[model samples]
Target: MAEPTERDPLIQKPTVFTDADSASRGEPATKQRLGPLEISASNRRGILAGIWLGTFLGVLTLVPTMMPSISSEFQKFHLASWLGTAYLLATCTFTPLYGRLSNVMGRRGANHTAIAFTAIGTVMCGLSRNMESLIAARFIAGIGGGGLFTTATIIVSDMYTLRNRGLVHGVASCFNGLGMGLGGPFGGLITDLLGWRAAFLLQIPLFVFALILIQYNIRYVTPGKSKGTMEMLKRIDYLGSLTLLVALGSPLFFLSARYNESLPWSEARVITPLILAIVFILGFLGVELFLAKEPVLAPGMLQQKVPVLVGASNFLVGACNFSVTYFYPMWFQVVMLQSASTAGMHLMPNSVSMSIGSLFAGWMMHSTGRYKRINLIFGIFPFIGTTLISRLREDSGPIHSWLSIIPLGFGNAVALHTMLIALLAHLPESHMAVGTGFAQLFRGIGQVLGVAISSAIFQSRLDAELRKRFHVPDAENLIRQIRRNSNYIRELPSEQQAYARDSYALALKTVYIFAACLTISAYLVRLPIPDQDLDKAHARQRAQAEARRNSTAEVATTNAVASTSTGSGLPTPEYPARSPTETETEPEEPAA
Candidate 1:
């Protein structure tokens, strides 16, 4: 046969890893060895737990604060928007694929692939020679970065029982919050001290260490028989993946072009892509529902009411969270006239609040075994915070700025932790990876939408305000220059500087109001999620485990008796059989 093409799937061979899932199902584990130390199934989870903080910190170094510096170096501040957009787009495109890919490659293989891609992309980013190359490099890194969090969540679900999963997730999210919290200041400081390229170059060592950790901890048990490469490749849903990409990318292109090109909504440049996006989305739905076998999105995954609502809520949460993250620094740096490093410092309150809120939400769920009330109570924070932030003036104080950001951070973190558990609780164990992947996909798209929408609004408002305020003979050219490079605001007369700052402050108010509306919508969607009793679910799992152990021991005793009787030429001894209450219980699927 001819060799596989580039488009052919790249799934790993069907070798069993013999993880805790199989051991729980009573399947005999295959012995594996590399050298002196033997790898055990029970200890596999320690791999990620040991390195969770470094893992997120390495990937989530948000560099929005460095945009001015990076743009200045490239001499194209107008195109700086693509820096964040490209990363979010690539992440959104590939995140769902990793979920299905993990099932075929095993988590260990999938994780290594993600890390390797990230390392390569990070180096490429550091070495980039122009704006386009940097954007391309960020896209590549995002492909890997997206999977890091998705796979970590899947592994966490596998490692813990539902009884304590909340706390475990909370701890994991706390590390994520730390990474988000620290990444800004760290990136800004690096940019200030050594330049922005060092920010990307410095992360390479952490990823290298992560790979060593995975290699030593996760051991694979070879399978008795494996399928051919072509057979496994044919099982992947290539059409669905491509169609989904188009469905998401087309609209993004429309929104981005509309702003970057300064085109009207009715212009063919914007209208054509919008129409194409709708058609492709419809095509994607049909492919998932009928054409693909073992769809990237499993059947009824979002067809159920709970999953649909959860996915929608996550989308809005993503919008609310990312909108603030991307623009909050801009508020400090442009309007308040702080240095990049100082602006990043101002982000500390938001990030710290997220860490505290995640832990609190986790503790509540672990203690009470409930999530509905927790979600409702926390969901209100984003709306309140956004509404308050909308009231900011050009002369707002540090206390006002810090106080406005805290509610957004705290509420969004709680919503993220609770929503994941809620989504998993409704899905079957087999669908956990895909379900979680879809959740990430939704949130990633929301990040892109949030930033894109906010950018468009900011640009339009800034242009209008500049025209209205400036009475110079060359006002239009001056406005364009100021819009392209925020640094130009400093070059203007002191009176013009005040006007420019006021324009930014007013435009941002509109953006915050838009985010506030999304938070309200998220709260409404969350109200109807059905509550599952986490404690009862924990009890059921324990009962089933005990049944399996008793059944295994009984079989061992019967085998010994028969062997003895045959050796002595005596009749086998009679033994009492288990009663209905003592009989083996039908095994239930593991809780997420």
Candidate 2:
């Protein structure tokens, strides 16, 4: 095959490596060998990128814990549910966009854009005087947050080979877990002492630090390079982006309306958006397959079984994860009668366990270079945990509640991260950003769907139970009050409070069962994933790259010898063909 010329689209300038000239000046070699693994001198770039990404995510996780306080202060209790939903909606919508953007704009540019959005949105949230403004600000922040996560993963792919990526991913996940785990308690404590706005304000400086770290440390080849801003814009799949936005945004709107307004599924408010969402999704798919020059979601990606299966499994995992995260605190507050801060404390076990599980899985993958069995074996924990959580009652103690989540958190960490590793394994290096982004898209979808479905189930059960137990004229008012303020249960008569707690617990049980089912379903989907050796794959890739470089060098030498012989009237030396084991083998004849 002909070597790539300078103008070839596949020709990428190496950003991570130092030239021989630079190395002669005592600079470290770009690539270093350590046992079976090849480590880049600039691997610190990937580490810093992961840290920044994790810290930003940790700040974002603070919202769920602060939701109650925001509701109480704003007197817009009904809109509080939208805080997480809105952020998730924006995240899902922008995830694929950011993936494609990173491919086009380079990781540094894309990440910086995301950080800017996050910082601005965070400041907006801090200054907002009402729930509507806060929700809008969260949506804005979600766009940046989504990009931060997607780009961070893509950057890791750029820096690390598949064999080593799992450990880095796990470390990053630990940071994410730390952020998410502490978010609740920290948000609660901060809100209690300084107010909810302080939670938003505190992240601004951290985001700035992340921005600076990424700017200075992270470097990679830009997949999609352009001469100017206009050229970059021209390359974007605008129609596909619009269609995707509508496709994702519409369903979220429908679900939010359905739950917040308590509207019937058949109502025009819900049905209209639901139909529109479907239409837009179909349109987006069509654009990807047929029309766009550079489809946001590559069409070929859909044809691959591994990516499809991994994405599907990720969707289920995402749903289970968000449902548990969102509802666990609610369960503590409503059924157990804990304050927001106390409820945040109750979530410590799951977060800590999740971090531990992620680290363990990462270590296992790094050591063994295998993950299929890990995914299969650890996948059962969430199912077991959720099953037990489904049985939690008013009488369940702190230990019972806390311990139940450990397995779920542990299982989720292992399965979800493994699936990600599997996905990166399945796709070519060129498509890594898009693949990671797509996985995150599914995760965002799962979160939105999980919250919406759980809310629907909880609302229906709570309403039915309240109506059946109370025949008084003010039963509707009593139900509304209970829904508005979980704390109101403590003021009710002892028998009434018992009934309320039982009703809430029952509703939560149903949600937990649903989450459990989703977890098991994800495991089943993951069963078909082939166990491939990541180390061997990386080795093969390195060999191919080396072969290409060798071929190019040999061709240059042959051309120089021919030119010298022709000019000097000297006999050209005949070279014997090299054997397979030779470092420099004979090049193939040029194709006709």
Model 2 Cα shift for residue 424 (angstroms): 1.5
Once fitted onto the true fold, the runs of candidate 1 whose alpha carbons sit more than 4 angstroms away are 1-45, 50-55, 220-230, 264-268, 538-592
Q: Candidate 2 — what's its lDDT?
A: 0.72
Pairs that clash in candidate 1: none
Clash pairs, model 2 backbone: none
- In model 1, what lDDT does residue 384 have? 87
Model 1 TM: 0.83
Question: Mind giving the per-residue lDDT tens digits that candidate 1 earns over 274-327?
Answer: 999999999988988888875655556666888788888888988888777777
Tens digits of lDDT, candidate 2, 474-580:
88788777666566778999888988887888777788888999999998988998988998767766666467646655664565455434643443323211111
For each candidate in turn, give its C-alpha RMSD to the true structure in angstroms.
9.5, 8.1
TM per candidate? 0.83, 0.83
In Å, residue 283's CA in model 2 sits off its true spot by 2.0
